[model samples]
Target: MSFASLGLNQTLLDAVAEQGYNAPTPIQTEAIPAILEGLDVMAGAQTGTGKTAAFALPILQFLSAQTRDSSGKISVRALILTPTRELAQQVHASVVKYGAQTDLRAALVYGGASINTQIESLKAGVDIVVATPGRLIDLMYKRAVDLSQVEYMVFDEADRMLDMGFMDEIQRILKVLPSTRQTLLFSATFDDEIFKLSKALLKTPKLIEVDARNTASIQVEQRVYAVDEDRKRELISYLIGSQNWQQVLIFTRTKLGADALAKEMCKDGLKTQAIHGDKSQGARERALEEFREGKTRVLVATDLAARGLDIEELKYVVNYELPFKAEDYIHRIGRTGRAGGTGLAISLVCEDENYLLQEVETKLETQLPQQWLPGFEPDLTREVKKAPRRNSRGAQKQRARERALGKKPTKRRR
Candidate 1:
């Protein structure tokens, strides 16, 4: 259905049309109506599903209908909490963009920036506030902002916030918000913890699951390459150089790994940038801008920056390092194949990551096809060795010796 049929204001609808969104996505179609009805909503949607617009559009419409008191200043009526600074900035941008034609004013507050600017924004009075939990709490403790009048509350990326250990901060923020406000929780996956938290926050909520859990987008072509750990960087360079991929998103396990890989790729003549939590907010934004604007051929990042990355038509995603959790595989590959656009996801699997690959296959309920590149095929002459029994003292002694020699110690047989 069209966004106009969702009961959005004419101006808001015009704004959405200007943004090139004429029809609502499945998630948006279900969520906007429920949110406008003042019902708590629990939505399960992956990145690039236009989930931000799902809530942002209705929020602007709802706020535009209300009449503020005199002084042209109103108490914060909505608070949107996100897990990371990037996501907060993204959601805040959506708010500003969608609410451009309305009387509503919105502001974003997060760490790694000047609190004085945030304090000034709050003091000026805004209709909606998007913030990270840490900085939100800081403002609350200082009495710089009041949430007693907040009627709508949104927890964007609820699962990520919990993963980053923001449960206590979320609980604290909840305590201060009005008890009668409408609560909405949006996430990529629904784990047991998400359900438990939902039960506590929602009141007979409208549950919307637009896609199956653990399912990657059908627009993505998935493949795996078996290579040694030391050769992964070279393999990536070869793939990018030979294939001439214009914009590629590479995922690494750590910030350090991301930085090093970006540097190496740059040395290989592919313009590259790294983004992670350790980088300054400005630096992270600049790197993402460069990648999005086609100025950089590759963007390496950790999993934390994987979510909320809304690049359109990203050609490829290279998994340089597999995540420890199998579910993260879905999120990583999701960086490509967005918005019904065809894309590719390639994983560089080392022999040591066999177990991780198996776990991922089990989660996806399908075996990822393995392809051998020319001159990059794994050596079949090498035998896969089994770990020795730990019960034998000789085996333990051998393992100790291998560890002392800077080798991977053999796993103890179960």
Candidate 2:
């Protein structure tokens, strides 16, 4: 169906046409109507699926229907929380573009920038605020923003936004929002934590899912290579050199690993860059820009650092090292195949990481096809893990909780 059929007004439809979007994605098709009807929605879709507009349009429509708050001013009526500054900026930009035809005001707040400027912007009283949790908390403490009038709340990346790291901050924010407000939770992937948070936050919410849970995009060609952990860097450089891939995104597990791998790739005569939390925001943005512009052939990054990274036409993603979490495998590989584009995802699995691979397989409920590259054969004499996978937090917690009850916990996947 068209955007017009999704309960959007003529102005938004005109905006959509101007943006050159002919129709809504699956998530949008299902979510916009329910959200406009004032229903709490929990939506799951992969990256680059136009998730921003799914909730943004409905939010704008709801706000446009009412121009002012009880104080006869444009107070903060909607709040969109994201995990990274890049994503917050990206979402805010989309909001401005969609709401351009209307008079709705929007503000952005995140760390690593001058809070005074954001404070000044909030002084004008915006209708919507797209912010990262930490900086929003800073604004809250400084009394630079007000959220008591917030009627619509959105968690853009629920997986990372409500994880153990940000849960405390989320709790602080949730305590301030109106309890009767409509909440929208969107995530690329889901786990036990997401489910628990949804239950605690949403009230009889409409569940919207595009594909099967924990599944990657079908447009992507997935493959796994068995090589020695020590020679993974060599294999990666050889693949890029032999295949002549100019734009490839690599995933590492830590900041140090990303930096070291980037250095080695640069030494191999391949232009490379590394981005992670340890680097300044300016450095991270510069690295991303250079990589996107094809000045760098490879970019190594950790999982957290890669959130909200929007790269159009990216065709290759390499897991230089497996992540400890299985859901992260899906997120990392998701960087390549986006917006219905065809791409390739390669995972370098050594013997030590077979357990992690098994965890991913369990999460997907299917085994990834494995093959060996020429001259990079691994020693097949060693046995892979025969035990049930238990690397995820849910499994660990279940084991502990069961032990307390004098019972054995069944093995579970992420």
What are the clash counts of all predictions, listed in order?
A: 0, 0
Best by TM-score: 1
| Cα lDDT tens digits for candidate 1, 1-414 | 898888888898899999988688889889998999989999998777889898888888878888988767678999999998888988998889988888788989999999999999999889999999999999989999999999999999898888889999999998988899889999887889999999989999999999987678787899899986778888999989988888899998878788888999899999999999898888988989988999988999998876678787887998887776777888888878876688899999876566667778988889997777778777767777553343574665555446334569887666
Please report how far candidate 2 places residue 306 from its true position, in Å: 0.2
User: Can you give the lDDT of residue 26 in candidate 1?
Assistant: 89
Worst-scoring 10-residue span by lDDT in model 1: 396-405
Q: In model 2, state the lDDT of residue 217.
A: 86
What is the C-alpha local distance difference test score of each model? 0.86, 0.88
Alpha-carbon lDDT of model 1: 0.86
TM-scores of the candidates in the order shown: 0.92, 0.91
Q: Candidate 1: give the clashing pairs.
A: none
lDDT of 2 by residue, 1-414 (tens): 888899999989998899989989898999999998899999999988889999999999999988564776778999999999889988999999999999999999998889999999999889999999999999999999999999999999899785529999999999889999999999988778899999989999999998898798888898999998778999999999998998999998778788988999999999999999999989998999999999988999988889888898999999987777788888888887777788999999877566678778998889997789989898777666354345465565455345323467775643
Candidate 1 stretches with Cα past 4 Å from truth are 383-414
